[model samples]
Target: MSIRDGGGTGEVAGRPRLAGPPTRLRAPPAASRPGVGRAAMPNAPPREFCTFYVAPPLLSPYFSVGGRACWEIKMRIARRAQRLAGTLAILVSVASATAAAGDADPDVYLLIGQSNMAGRAPIPDDAQGPLDRCVLLNDRDAWEPAANPLNRYSTIRKDLKMQKLGPGWGFAQALLAAAPKARIGLVVNARGGSRIEEWKKGTRFYNEAVRRAQAAMKAGTLRGVLWHQGESNATDPDYLDKLKQLVLDLRADLGKPDLPFVAGQVAKDSPVNAHLARLPQTVPGTACVSAEGLKTIDGTHFDTAGQLELGRRYAESINKLRRAE
Candidate 1:
């Protein structure tokens, strides 16, 4: 995608760049405040994983033809191989065309959030699955898995290895299932341990994310953003206003004020109370999904299955919004 004249050089706010994890609300002493989400109420343990899978490379075969003939047999075998290769190529091209021509054009969704958006998931040994319309934009603008869950920068405090199981994958799967004609492109830009304020426009991470998403949009690849953040805002009293402004700023910058954006509330009993947590979703043109039954044991994230469910919830939210529009 072509970059605007001063696009990549602008700073977010007056800050030189985003530095460190943004400030979250300070944890209050046990006696003073109510906790976040349901985990705070009773016997709820943090959600845990049942399995995991790492993706593998896709392979294509190469063939050489040999024959027992002095001349004609060898020529025939070579011709046959050439015809077979041509047929295979045509089949592949047809498949790709069919996939693209289904119903609605698939969207490239940007998943930006905190640790929950990045962590791990359990992909099966046979899970090298289809990616006809899914893609992720790295810092370099190359496409990888649009929904990789593991935040390379975030630490999973637990002894168990965290797998890549972010909600974006589920969202993609759900969208495909519901609308086979739609393609889903995902770009992740969430930083673990980072707060909302840290994501302000000028920071490197913020600018980088904006650059990536904007590039995708300019290339006509992105459809919208799937935002699930705000645990960091638990401590910021002015968070609601700031978040509202952030949404306005993003739409203005992206040139899609009516962009189909969908977001989710954090699970109950989080560091921030549930009531206050719902404010950002209230912003115009933004939709929010309830996190009541979701959330992991640590109370800060969603478990593997929870992430899938969250993705489904997000798809439903998006579909409903689209229908409303």
Candidate 2:
């Protein structure tokens, strides 16, 4: 039989012709019914025929026109999923890195000067312990829990066996207490009987202090400098000039020109008390704390109570400076 063209005669030559428009063969609808696609059904019963019917497009090699479209759709979906997963992974990594950086940034304070800054009094029972949020940069260039006798390398002391209490411990404690969430790091480089001349730029003590301060800065931000000296330079005529120069040199070395330098006055009876009291006026970004009422152990270094008070005073001055900034 011959096929008839639309609007053509019913018969072609002597053969009979098929009637009407020819019916086109189409692949069956894709298996979109639940539990009937390529995916397996969950919790199917034993002996159950969970048929995952392949569409007619996949039945023959030469009839794979629809199958190509299906494969391409799947590929697009897979690429989209991979891109989404990669984006999520990158976001998580960035968030983790930011948190780690914040955790490592603490408030760092540099403590330097002479015996008073080194703490020459006996450690009080209440102050003879380590602070949780305070870390001391020791002479060995290591970070350890901050406690009493912070300036361990003071030349006046033979060993830590006879270590005396210094204001550093109390200063850290007070600062931490005032700012509960703050992580405080103390870089103590004070030495007993250290004169202002010894702390001049290019000197061993000044170089060491700068080195330690720079090292401590790696673990946190440099906040301020706590200075309590003048006992040895009391009689020097150029004491104030040398001290002012020291502050400038320190700021230059640390790369923090406006860094706060809080100096504490010597005992009331000390001959250098008058000079120390004028520190704030003589130096920029500097303040002086009073030791007028504080008692001394042997008419020189502060006693336990005095050290604690001095630390609190230093913390107060530091806080004030920070607020002004």
TM-score of each: 0.61, 0.67
Candidate 2 residues 97-139, lDDT tens each?
3344334355888888887887778887876667776767665
Q: Tens digit of lDDT per residue, candidate 1, span 141-193?
A: 43334434423322221222453667777787888898865556566666656
The CA-based lDDT of model 1 is what? Answer: 0.53
Prediction-by-prediction clash tally: 35, 1
lDDT of 2: 0.66
Error of 2 at 15 (Å): 99
Worst 10 residues of 2 by lDDT: 66-75
Question: Model 1: runs farther than 4 Å from truth?
Answer: 1-106, 121-132, 144-163, 271-282, 295-297
